[model samples]
Target: MSNIPPAGMSAAEWQTRQELAACYRLAWHFRFTDLIYTHITARVPGEDGHFLINPYGLSWDEITASSLVKIDVDGNKVADSDYSVNPAGFTIHSAIHRTSHDAAWIMHTHTRAGVAVSSLEAGLLPLNQIALQFHGRIAYHDYEGIALDLGERERIVASLGDKPVLVLRNHGLLTTGATAASMFNTMFYMERACEIQVATLSMGQPLRKVPADVADHVATQYQSSMGEEDDVLLEWAAHLRLLEKIAPDYRD
Candidate 1:
């Protein structure tokens, strides 16, 4: 549990670090990784303006509880780490953490299908059930080149506007949750939604659009289903169990 030097924080942060690390490994096993480029970050418990992210130089699978880096909103390391942090990653994440009060964990990805649907003008259309889950719940930010510039953060925050999912046009997908597990759940389904949208659109058939009312119901169903105790506990426990079977050392 003590992969990095003691930062004088509580045990809650260590637990968050372990979960964030496992999320990285799960992302790797599930093919959500983009080499060492994308990130999944969690806010440090009891600390404002601070969050945990993967060490920049390591692949997702190589990340562990102790190897995660803690950095302030200013992109400065708050703890002693042998690895550097990525400026671009913080540029995107800090904007949300700085503004949205509920975004305890933020997951960003550049998956092939995710980028594919993001490139579409319709942007995750209600073409299928999976895609419908995000009807009216997805937010869009026009392409603004690489996200390294600090000025773009404000516009990004404006576009997010309290939505759970943000689709960066011509880029990729991002999800926010009050917990790491909820955040992972959003990305897992969001990526699937994108994949379904791309596949259905590629078929080039006349779309059988879901009725607007039905889409609304489905979307609301998804929203209402969130934060349920049994569902959250079971799904996250299963994911942890699977990770334990294959990559148990993430807890290090």
Candidate 2:
């Protein structure tokens, strides 16, 4: 809400804007966006504390590089924009931002596959290597309906403690990262993992799962060998290029 920059915003702030905006467009292209419901936020470039988020009510595909609003950790609109932000969106994002120092980029979604998996009593069954990667890292936050109450922040924060990803029970998914790319990549993997797990479970056959030690080894290798650059934005760039060929209006 305040106009004060978290630190001082720099010329690079504009670049962060473009990338974050591109992320939104890419989300729509992936069909990861849920109308105007989900939110993706990025910290302002060269600024220590401020971030940019979409104004509520705008379809994710409608977001443009220049249309994002600046806001502090408190969730007030700091910049001039025609669009408004949802308090619930701010509530979820702000809690993570405040508690997690590594959360430079945060994303949340309610994809059908994600919500379906969340509702299942089993919750993200380890039916494959992907699910196993999150064997101990993923946290679960029971849904409290629309996430408007400030009281929910405590539980949300506690559930997400030290974990990079969270599956909000009967609600959706949340991911935190050191960059927008990493967070997006995490969400994509989590959603896919859930989708496959659900589909596999529906088959009603004996399910094959990875050994916990092997899963941990693979996850450690992924972290050490691949590193952060191997995230969604690399492929996401290709996705945006494809969107340009088809739904060019998303750039508007």
lDDT of 1 by residue, 1-252 (tens): 344534675788888999899899999999999999989999998898999988998999999998999999899999889999888899999999888889999999999999998888887878777777678878999998999999999999999998989999999999999987888888998999877777787899998988899999987887688546568768988999999799899998
Candidate with the greatest lDDT versus the true structure: 1
Candidate 2 lDDT, 151-235, residue by residue in tens: 8887889999988898899889899888766777788788889889878878999977777778778778767665457545676
Cα error, residue 57 of model 1, in Å, equals 1.5
Candidate 1 is scored at a TM of 0.94
Clashing pairs in model 1, backbone N/Cα/C closer than 3 A: 3-66
List candidate 1 segments past 4 Å from native: 1-7, 225-229
Q: Number of clashing residue pairs in every model?
A: 1, 1
lDDT for position 236 in model 1: 84
The deviation in Å at residue 124 for candidate 1 is: 0.3
Give the whole-model CA lDDT for all candidates, comma-separated: 0.89, 0.78
